[model samples]
Target: MENNFAENISPAFSSIYEEYETLSKENYCDIYRRNTIRKHVETYLNPKDTILEINAGSGIDAVYFAKAGYNVLATDIADSAGIYIKNKIKTEGLKNLEFQKCSFTDLSSIENKKFNHIFSNYGGLNCTNNLEEIFSQFNDLLHPKGFVSLVIMPKFYPWEMATFLKGNKNAFRRWKKNGVLANVNNHLIPTFYHSPKQIKRAMGNDFKAVSIKNIGTFYPSLHYNSLHKHPKTINFLMHLDSWINGKSIIPKGIGDYFIITFQKNT
Candidate 1:
């Protein structure tokens, strides 16, 4: 059953990616939500390093990284991603960035190259049914002492738990299940959820955890647009969340996502 489910995963994600590209800037959930992660990248990455971004949705981050002087290679399995990202690169007149169509499972296509840094934002890797395989591939592509940063959806999130307790059982149920089939344009894709410890364990000796920070600790998911109606309130909450997020271990799980940074062993 798992094998069959995994085999059918691409179609569902393809549909989701297609719809995601069509969404207008105002309606795009990733832009505002990814602000925190983008800030982190700005802080850590240097100008000379070569960076590879997996699941480079719409090339937003790619453009940012390229402008910052990093040689950027952005890739995604989505059929529309290449065209969308290329157009973005052209529009921005960014010369340092290149876009490609590739799946996380198959890094062999680009294996001859090594990257100084590798990143995937917004739960892109979590969509895969097998994480260990992906990690193994990542290990191969990274240069010695390279950095790998990923923003992922942990199995437990406070908002989701609270929402579930308030009679929305389906929201809570997604975490309990080890694997879930996300519906995208009438297609089903297998998605795997992991805990922080599980992810660390999977990376094993190849990568060392440098930092693990919480994102959106108080700023709820973008799906809840009702919260955005109050700008002052949302801004206050976001500031408080950012302060507490870096300090507390437990509060990190309260957010919808977490950013985990790992450095490859030299």
Candidate 2:
């Protein structure tokens, strides 16, 4: 991880970045989500392919993929990430993993880098509305027939609606047009929800859809983290989640988040 790579990082989201692992680290729902997302990516691309990962928070996924035999360049806007990422590299002795403090919108720092696979997880791209500007850069970075996998929130989620019924006021925040202000540790960060269609359209003719899979559909939200205490209930929910985890009859863009994969096309 480079020391001076991240520049102009906002003070608002900076604390959220530093406290991210603390927030989700104990959430079992998040643990399941990460493993499921990794399985989908592994199924889509080979370990031999190098990956350029944007918004690589805490570098957990980067380290996981690197240990699984993939070379990964993990980029994040959080300078605080350097400390955690560096510690992981030193302790894990990871040679295939590299870290850069880069934002997806401005790839100029890594513009010369080419990769067979690009990954951004957990709605990091939702922070900005300039996706067209972002996807245009993908044309230059991805090899022909290479893959891009993103995990993004949709306009609507059934489970979120269920949470709404239970009095979670922010449940329907995705409906906001200009985007919603995500209250992270009392700091407001703007977030936008995007559908799979919107993402593919922005990706343009240079990419073709490969798969759309449910992530956390039928699985209880981490907000319901207490459900983890009940083994029988957890087993039943996990079974339903497994049934809907991969490609299914369920339409796209209807999960807590969906992992959509696209391949670069000539």
Candidate 3:
């Protein structure tokens, strides 16, 4: 087995990850947030291309892509994630989606398969220390002109720093090179924060940056559970984001999460 830079994942914890994440899930306005990301992701994806989704939590995004008429192979380190997608596949009779229990760094099981796109969402790769190792593999896995879209946390997000006002000392946790341990379901998981520059270098010279858009920026955070209650405010932010998102509108290092896309240099 290769060294898993995502130091804390294990079979025992895998079964409970979804449950552990419920607390955050309940606090997050996911529907609105997901639609926002999906809108951006689909713009870069070709419906005919097979997508390999890493860190596929609950296989939600995979199912979404499949339903939209794309072929998808959803892979996750957690075995439970496989179960969720399998159940969804069976229930929906989805023919275009496949599931596998796999880790991002160790995708040897599917080495023979090549894809036109790669995706990972919700900062799942943040658990690993080896950003370069992961990105380097994309060149081999993707065809020429292939795209990779990742929604991951950057080394800095302005809103999180506001935690200092709430008297939280670990406001700048992402700044730590060694990473910090996040408590989930009484389990401490190691989480790392990466910057766009670091990811670009890790992607080597084979990949070119396509676009970087702010995932959660300004006014209300994605984690703000009650966003639905304030539809007007959220709408304004969405409207504002539309203008500044993909056109290099939002400044780097300012979003709670960022959707960074890269394309293989043909």
Candidate 3 per-residue lDDT over residues 81-124, each given as its tens digit:
87788998999999999998888877766867889899998888
What is the lDDT for 83 in model 3? 78
Candidate 3, position 249, lDDT: 60
Winner on lDDT between 2 and 3 is: 2
TM-score of every candidate = 0.88, 0.89, 0.87
Residue 127 lDDT, candidate 1, scale 0-100 = 79
lDDT for 165 (candidate 3): 97
Worst 10 residues of 1 by lDDT: 21-30
Tell me the lDDT of candidate 2. 0.78
Q: List the residue pairs that clash in candidate 2.
A: none
Give lDDT tens digits, candidate 1, residues 1-266.
Answer: 35644565555555565455454245434555667788876566767789999988777678778887889999887666777778878888888899878877777788567898899987887776567888888877888888999888887766667776668856765475667776656766666676778788888888899888887777767667787677788777777777787667454444688888899888
Q: Please give the distance, in angstroms, between residue 133's alpha carbon in candidate 2 and its true position after superposition.
A: 1.0
Q: What ranges in model 2 sit over 4 Å off? A: 1-27, 245-247
| Clash total of candidate 3 | 0
lDDT of each: 0.75, 0.78, 0.77
Please give, for residues 49-118, the per-residue lDDT of candidate 2 as tens digits: 8999988877878988999989898988776666678778889999999888777867867956789899
Task: Point out the worst 10-residue segment of candidate 3 by lDDT.
Answer: 1-10
